[model samples]
Target: MNKPNQETLDELKAIYVQKIKAEFPKQLKNFSDKNAKEHQLSQLRGYLHKLVGSGESFGYTDITHTARAAESIATSLMSESTKDKPSRLTYLVKLLEKLAGIVDKIEIESPVTLHSGANFTDRQSNAKLLTVGQAHIAKTERKHTICVWVIDDDESVAAQLSEQLLSFGFDVAYFLSCAAFKQALLSSQPHFVIADVRLEDNSDFYRCADLHRIDLKSFGLIIMSAFDDFHARIKAVRSGAITYLQKPINVARVASFIHEHKNKIQLHPERILIIDDDTDLSALYKSQLEAAGMAVHNLSDPRKVMAAIQEYQPDLVLIDLYMPDFSGMELAAVIRQFDNFTSLPIVYISSETDNQRQSKAIATGGADEFITKPVSADILITALRTRVKRARQLNALISKDSLTGLLKHSAIKEAVKSEIARTSRDRQSLCISMLDIDRFKRVNDTYGHAVGDTVIESLANLLTQRVRQTDHVGRYGGEEFMLVMPGCDAESAQVILDDIRERFSNIEFTVGNKGFHCTVSAGFVQLEASVFLPTADSLVEHADSALYEAKNTGRNRVVQSITARI
Candidate 1:
């Protein structure tokens, strides 16, 4: 995610070209031999393979293709020639001569110009392979502690909110008045400002808001008020408030709101897996792509492509078409064999220029596109970004709920089953929760289905905001939702779900001019791998039973399954 050192990259390119040129005499001698030894042929094959990868990367297409031809000949000869040896040897020798000529003529551009079209971030860490979930955890670990400043004349309100935020893992400071808050701001700023709309006759708060809008535009401002009037809301909006919360402030809701904002601002770098036998070329691709705000993993051995895919879960795969044992098309087909990866984008980035063969590769339904070698950095970035975005949109359309944008019923069930299998293997705990809006039929009858739908959307957003990136939330159907949390115990699940329950109860929904609140009941079952053999259906059923108990006792609560309570 950092800006790549173009000078370093260009220098590397120059070094590669020079290295090839220096090795030209030995390569020529090997190719000239009618009966080359296996070791000599093997060395020639390795050299040609490097050229096939790096030549195109450095924009030497002629050299890449020449090397490819020579490499093919070397491979055939090493494997015991089945073709006319004299003709093959002549062709191979000519190809090696052509490759040497191309290398001699290769030009290295100094301080290569980098495209600034994409916004790149500072990764701060060394490049490595990690799944999106693992990346999220790493990001969280590196993130600075969020500090929240609560400005309210009401001491009780400020203290209660501050305490709750502290419990929710935020550093909190409360000021009794705007003056005290302003004084603190002069010293240092908090990540968020939760200010009462009326602090000392409301005049001081408005003045403070004006100061914040002008001087501290970066920090998030959450305006809290007892008033639900249009005028008050407009004033808050004008003052650059991110959200206006009605007092009787739900701390969990505020926390969720903050998290939503954070998610929006966070840079989730695109994941890319480059499968190529050439480590040097793969390294170059990794560096260039990472500079353009993508996470890249390089795997030289095609045999480990499956393991890399499962572990790294890349958004797009860039494969060299001519690896030793398995071709890129073969690997692509293997990846497509899995239902989960059928939609994943596979692109062949090689020097292969045969149009008919390229068409055949794509027609096989394995590869999405063929990117010929010598692609400009800008073109490569644009092509990859476009493919990844479209793929995600397509995947979402197939698996996401139309109403809430969470996973659909079957998709969620499948996700649960997969997680259960993983938990069984890892011998970790898994929590499955079922949630339903309280008295949803009454809500629809009173406020109509449109308002009911709005409530459902609101809850969906809340669940998405509160859950971890590793957790899965799905619209189970209608007003019900399902949450799957791997490696979570019942007690932790209860705590999280209870907070969400309390927060949902405090979310005010307006129908016409009347503002009202809604509630939800949640039931979760935690499966201990040592004690229980978990299945998706059994987990859902137990959680549903717990939800029934929660509804029976009282609405607006979270309950752990009696059968699996820890």
Candidate 2:
């Protein structure tokens, strides 16, 4: 099955869920009627069966299972005489209510598809809503929200800290001792940690060392020392504290730090690939694209187009229409042969102004948009941005893992191919990592699909947070993720995979009241141009083989491809 991107999956899921919810209650109510029960059970069964068939495609396995169970119960109730089995009818109604609750709780993670109405055009209305909502969220979330940990032994200092932080819309957590602060750090994961240099029994020595071990470099840490001596200040700096405050604490400086770093801390920039045979043209396009603040790759050789694309797995592509030996039309045609590249945007740019020539360019393959040269800088930039944005939207429609916000299996394959192609042409190293959630099926079977989805979402978030900005990470079907790392060799990629494996192994998940931990097994293949010339299928297969080795050897570790070593 082709996997849709997050936006596409969310839209589809929302529509499917809304449709089921709207229709099911009416169907259930009709079923309870004296004459309606005779005919309604068949309709209910049919609807539930349809949902079961389609739900997994949208990453709504929980909804699928519920529908399946409801279908079974409805079937059983229908078999019994209604007059003799009133309890059976009640059970069916209760099941329908439960299904309704599940549907209600399902969040609509993407924009809804607009429907036309007689009054206002639905598309226009939805566009307006999206614009407003986006602006609002961007404004709201961009504001600095400081989170501080107060590790003061005094009860009054701890209590006052919370009130002071709260006045400025900051979140504050108090810890009475070093041990209490350490325990709070494990669960709360606050943005900043503040501690007194002098703790009870001089335990600050070990406590400061422990905090440093947790990689608090990115976070703000201030040591409050009552002693004004230079020795105490030096001790605080050596212990890995950012700043040492002498007795008096400045709330203003702390606020300033939060404000300065708030926007600085963000997810990595998205990687983009540009394929054009003209070196001058590629550079020109790359400059404009880079100015827009996107990571861009430019390739001038059509022969290595696929290799470059696979290595970068770019979010979008801008291909020149005419090349020396192979035209952009021919290259796009070749790309279309691969299933992963079917929906990828391959925009053609050329000086060919004839209408017939433009039509011919598009006719060669799946050309999304065309640009006639000499391309205007602003016009070209707008066109590329629009194509990239649309690609993301289309991917959301068809290639998103609804719960995880990652690329669906088919999308991930396409992205990997594009990345590999880019890396190969650029002679940059590239890596592909296949990650499998260990004992995932067991989790699903034991705690139901709802809990399983939470686990998947959490893992996806962690992978996204850990990977480099240039890396491509996506959901490679059920309980598995695929990562494409450009400019990374086998050793560096292994280090990254191992770090992710360790972090994921320690993450604890709780569903209702039951807490459980899960681990991931990874197989990664890092390829240099000298070593395995980049092809999408070859790279993916190599990585998959390594992943198989990791799983066979034992879960929760990373294995590199032996083929690459050879």
Candidate 3:
């Protein structure tokens, strides 16, 4: 296997370091609380167990052994028998102390940039701005329509904050007070409400029951207070505030907070495959997962686990511990054999809650997690959501371009290969296109690299918006991109690409006071159902030839590959 380029390694490293920073504090707090509640201890043990397994994989050998030992002690303490809890707690503390030292020693060249103004943040913000357009275009582009209700008595603050949020693409609604908000709620409810902690009439915050309405997901509550009293904060939390912000807040930070929470409610529905012989229980689980906006498929046949996984391409899998044909652990081992499914999470669902036995099963079977039966709906949802989110983050770190958020070079190739197989198997029409920015090198030389980057990002954003949702768009490399259009012929593909090319060329870009325009040359190859299908590599080569042809012809047009049997 070839070693990855330095850029890819740097991206992967940066993501791992960020994960450590974000998670280490919570893990340390949990580890230090030897007298924590049982559930807290259980959570700590599970986290440490996962950390132990993943830390080594990411080359954090410094803490892996210590985390592994701590996990063992945690497992012992969490077991039903409590006779050894005192000794295990002492030993776990020692291990944690040592682990802290190890964590301090593990070095990462770069830190995660969470705040604005950082290079990554600036890139993301600028790229998003490229998508800034008319109200309806923004609405169509948004994955979920997030309507934020801001209830504050201060008209000045409310007006300014509303404008800022609207800039961030949120549908904003403002109210003068809680009374107005409640009246509006009676007719329509927003996804999130940001209200002052105190009202002039002292009316109770939102009715908690309204948020618990089963017909819809729970609404978000954010409390804004001018007071710094401990009781005020506590009251806000008790009143169901997901976030509490002080007065004179940075509106941008507030928007970021709300958007972060909004993302929780609007994630792309993760796909999950469940293999359990208990049909009734599986169906119940399936419905619960679906209610959380996950795509779920449940199969009663344990023997078909591999086939089901390949077909569903699920982010996570749930398997019953006891099945008539095979045990969940055995099936998990089989699934791990396939390289494509190696990172897919396999969680075992069983009635047994014994910590020791669960640890052993996890280790022996190479599974990610074990959930005892009779779990609460919230716990199940939270557990699966956390795993899926982490897996996706990891996947993005390795597969996504750092600057543009498009698939990396290698990932795009893999996508092309997969598309070829899919089109061949289904006998569907498909088109592959290559696009290159005209005179990109000249832009970088003329107006610094940052301006050049802005040009690239603008084009990427245009492609993301103009293309159909079903199309696959990736940044093949610098100044070049690949587009795979399934169920489309050369004519339709050309129409779409040509339109994008025109729109992209019309985008007015500026560096200081000087302004300029950019254009793209695109070429496509269509796989006709009646013609002999070409290999992915062959198609890519033909598309490249066509792209150059477009560049040679006039420098800003779409050209079709001359790949017919003629």
Predicted structure with the largest TM-score when compared to the true one: 1
List pairs with backbone clashes in candidate 3. none
lDDT tens digits, residue span 1-566, model 1 = 24567654765576566566667777777554766778877877877776776777776778777888888888888787576877877888878777777777866555333222121112223223332234222234313346678988888878877876655555678998766776766656567888887877656587765665435455788898888999889988887889999867755456656755753332456799999886657767777887787879888888988888876879999998877678888889899999889888999987667799899988774799999876767888889988988887788899999877799999999989988877877788899999999999999999899878777877887787567767899999889999999989888898989878887776667665677888899998988886556567888999999999999997788888887733
Q: lDDT of each model, Cα atoms only?
A: 0.77, 0.67, 0.71
lDDT of 3 by residue, 1-566 (tens): 11223443354456656666667777777655546677777777766654553464456665567777787777677775787677778888788778777776766786554432245435533544553442332345444456787877778888877765554445678888655665566655577877776555664444432443322224787888777888878877776678788876555456545644555565367889988764434544654566566778878877777767766778899877655457778888888888888888889887545799898888877899998765655788899989999999899799988766678888888888877777776778888999999999999999889877777766765565466656788999999999988888877887888878877776666555566888899998887665455677888998999999999998999999888421
Give me the runs in candidate 1 sitting further than 4 Å from their true place: 5-32, 37-46, 56-268, 530-532
Q: Taking the tens digit of each residue's C-alpha lDDT, what string does model 2 give over 1-566?
A: 11223343344456555666677667666665345464577777766655553454346667667776777777776776656466666666677787788777777665465442212224433644564365322223322334667787776866665554443345567777776765555544556677776666666644554764555554567777677888888877876676777645544344444444443333233356766644433544554555555567767667887777665677676776755467778888998888767877888876545699799889876788887655545676677766776777676778777666688787788777767666656878788989999999999999899878767765676675567656778988888889988888888888878877876676556555556778899998877777456577777888889889999998788999997742
Model 3 lDDT, residue 95, Cα: 84
User: Model 3, residue 172: what's the lDDT?
Assistant: 79
Off by over 4 Å in 3: 1-267, 468-470, 529-533, 564-566
* All candidates: CA RMSD (Å): 8.1, 24.7, 19.7
Model 2 lDDT, residue 432, Cα:
90
